[model samples]
Target: MALLKRDFIPVSKQQNMKPLHYPDCIHLSERCGCDLLSISECKGESCSFCQSAAQQELSQREWLSILNTLGLEQQKKIAGKYYSGKMPWKSQQKKG
Candidate 1:
């Protein structure tokens, strides 16, 4: 009896075989706040539509804007602690 050798490819290399482009969920129009064309040209970190899609549970853009007002160290601290416990919904509770 002869033993046969099997070839295996790693997942990381397999992923590079095809590039992924997600469709625009939030259509950018004159009514929408962001300029889709400009945002598309750069890395999508600051894009509101992309941010909202990635963090579906909360409003990422609003948090990002608030973080921007704080110092870099404070921003890191808040971001690290944000997921540690229940988020304070004081404002939302007051609204109702």
Candidate 2:
């Protein structure tokens, strides 16, 4: 029921050359053991993360597709957890 390395997400950095920030650092997924992109900062895109057997080529939509493919249960759980039962949230919080 956790978003392990199989659900790793790309880490994005701020605009001022600061460290990358994860919007949801408390979720089970944030603990994913995937290697982060540390060599260079993300341009908000043009970066990627590997989720176990699946590698997302730096598209947020692609990552979400993987979750949806995990099955309806997972998709619902994720949507209820972070999306506020709506489109992706611009802010990260357990709104619903």
Candidate 3:
């Protein structure tokens, strides 16, 4: 069967799929990362609309764990290139 427009999720949508049990965040629909239309990248604990701190923390941890899968040198390179050697998550850890 041929697919319809609504039947096909964009690649961007596939990347920014909302976390399970995440709230219907206003920013999700307002500032979407997918086509800049459906939902914005989740801000986790930084989002004002986040309903549950525990859920946000868990989600952030999961995302961070993905980076941990990378080799130590590759991770360091990414940290230096993108994060200027100061990881944002580490700062948040200090704050929380």
Candidate 4:
């Protein structure tokens, strides 16, 4: 008899996949390196919406997900490139 525990209880239907349950498939790009991509590229510089043509850009969640798999130094480099521009983020905005 194996030592691995087996659940005799029937799995509940409530245990369904989340809306964002995307499998980790890897893709390599000259600009972004290896990424777990569903949609191909980032749209309108981090703008995400429903459309085929607008699906080129990576979503914000995808960017952050890719970042989590990266080293600190590489993360810094990527962040630098994106944030260096006129980012509309509140953090980049000056407080008066």
Best by lDDT: 3
Worst 10 residues of 4 by lDDT: 1-10
lDDT of 3 by residue, 1-96 (tens): 211112223457448543332244333432333322344555533555544445567788876777767787877888899999866755555565
| Model 2 spans with C-alpha error above 4 angstroms | 1-57, 87-96
Among the numbered candidates, top TM-score falls to 3
Native-to-model Cα distance after best TM-score fit, residue 71 in candidate 3, in Å: 2.0
Per-model RMSD to reference: 16.5, 15.1, 14.0, 16.5
| Per-residue alpha-carbon lDDT of candidate 2 for residues 1-96, written as tens digits (9 for 90 to 100) | 213222334455643333433322122133332236443322222223323222233344566556645766766677787877754532322232
The superposed Cα distance between candidate 3 and the true structure at residue 31, in angstroms, equals 14
Residue-wise lDDT of candidate 1 within 1-96, one digit each (tens)? Answer: 212222233448546433333334343333333455644332333444553344443564555456566786765666568845433332334443
How much lDDT does candidate 1 score? Answer: 0.44
TM-score per candidate, in order? 0.23, 0.28, 0.35, 0.27
Order the candidates by TM-score, highest first — what do you get? 3, 2, 4, 1
TM-score of predicted model 2? Answer: 0.28
Backbone clash tally (model 3): 3
The better candidate by lDDT, 3 or 4, is 3
Q: Against the true structure, candidate 3 has what lDDT?
A: 0.52
